[model samples]
Target: MSIKVENLKHIYAPNTPFETIALDDINIEIKTGEFIGLIGHTGSGKSTFIQHLNGLLKSNYGKIFINDLDITDEKISLTDVRKKVGLVFQYPEYQLFEETIEKDIAFGPRNLGLVEDEITQRVKDAMQLVGLEYERSKDKSPFDISGGQKRRVAIAGVIAMKPEILILDEPTAGLDPKGRDDILRNIKEIHEKEKNTIILVSHSMEDVAKLADRLLVMNRGKVEFFDTPKEVFKHEERLKQIGLDVPKVLDLAKKLREQGFDISDDILTIDDIKLEILKNLKEK
Candidate 1:
């Protein structure tokens, strides 16, 4: 029901010109049903870290425990691990190969040897979760959909597996503003309805700021902080050093604070800040 990583380290092409530390002595714990926003600049090891959660990248250098099962142990079932921790990588839609959207979404569940009826239900339910109309899109080729809808199909494929831990790396990458907003809302629905341990990786502080209950900031393969968004944004200089700024909402809050606004806490979301501003105006 949780993921625990200790001293995780990964080196790429060691002893060669491409040698680099991809993950450096990382340690963190993720509890069940927690919505975590994983934020870091490009090459900050965010992808590398999430890959290890599902056994996609084995770590001989560190130990990872998922749901209290040692992932590295010989007795562990990697297949089960993957079934429990579903990962949706950037451009996941590109991996879609089935002739029809229904088949593509059903692939994972089918592989689990689910009954035909169960697989069908899973496909229907997953598509519904992603806002895809099962009756309309089922027979259509995945390539025939809009880019955002294609992405939804890919994500539905993973959700069909009913993974306990869902890791989404830049789920909104390359999306337009409205596409990004739609995807973020879909993810929130998934978290709320499924109650999975969700880890959303993105560089956009604003996107994560609105959805994440907790933020995990990374820099140079190291964890900077793992705390509630309000608490984490309080370290403005530390975030700046990592080439990240606090969410603009919080930045505005800070500026208003200096100008004699009596706002007492960091405002991490657009909605919350708007409410506060309106309340203050009404009071005045």
Candidate 2:
């Protein structure tokens, strides 16, 4: 589904002593089947922005449109908005509370008043989508699963709702390297197979560079840059000024270029760097 935010502004604790503007005239447009990455340091309004997409947090000013429907309208149901846009918050595993894995993953559809058979079918489908064996683990307690499994269960809960757009906030946070990679791969697979729009909120430049077709950089409640990863990462100095860094490989490529090497400064991945170096050596 397409998402559009126009002149959005959000303020925390309005009319209070600690009033802080979290979003400042933020405007963004995301197309269907696109993977967009949002990057910023802490307190950059990334979290607050994603909350607005799913109607979790209402905008104080401005409007959000999902597939041409104005979500900010009072007549619109927040539940309907959420059904179309699923949000998996940071550390989602902490939110798993059901006794069994199947029950936990089925909660969303069940709450929507789906029939028991349909909910069961959705639970099985979600588990399979996340690479879990439903029959083997359906009866087990979610608490008894490993950290990665628990994370998958939490994601399955959202997937069971069959959202057209999936918004993940720091999906790799607080996981071992293997666990992080596993989750990232699963998410990528789902995006590829389902052709769903994805918005990834993360602090890791490398992760964004590798996954996102476009990047949005936020600073102090404002969007500083919105463009392709190559365009956004070109402003290394500006990003650093805002307490962000480019991908490590891109930084290294920049240094190599400074040293007069025949390499592209836009090399954002290890494979790209290796191929570039090999091609240059062959030409020499």
Q: Highest TM-score: which candidate? A: 1
- In candidate 2, the residue pairs with backbone N, CA or C atoms under 3 Å apart (3 or more residues apart, or in different chains) clash, namely none
Q: How many backbone clashes does candidate 2 have?
A: 0
Candidate 1 C-alpha lDDT tens digits along 56-165? 88875989998889997778889999999999999999999999999999999999999999999999999999988899989999998888998999999999999999
What would the TM-scores of all predictions be? Answer: 0.96, 0.95
lDDT of 1 at 58: 80
Backbone N/Cα/C clashes per model: 0, 0
Question: Listing every candidate in turn, what is its Cα RMSD in Å to the true structure after a full C-alpha superposition?
Answer: 1.3, 1.5
Task: Write one digit per residue (lDDT tens) for candidate 2, span 116-160.
Answer: 999999998888888899889999999998898898999999999
Q: Which regions of candidate 2 fall more than 4 Å away from where they truly are?
A: 258-260
- lDDT of prediction 2: 0.92
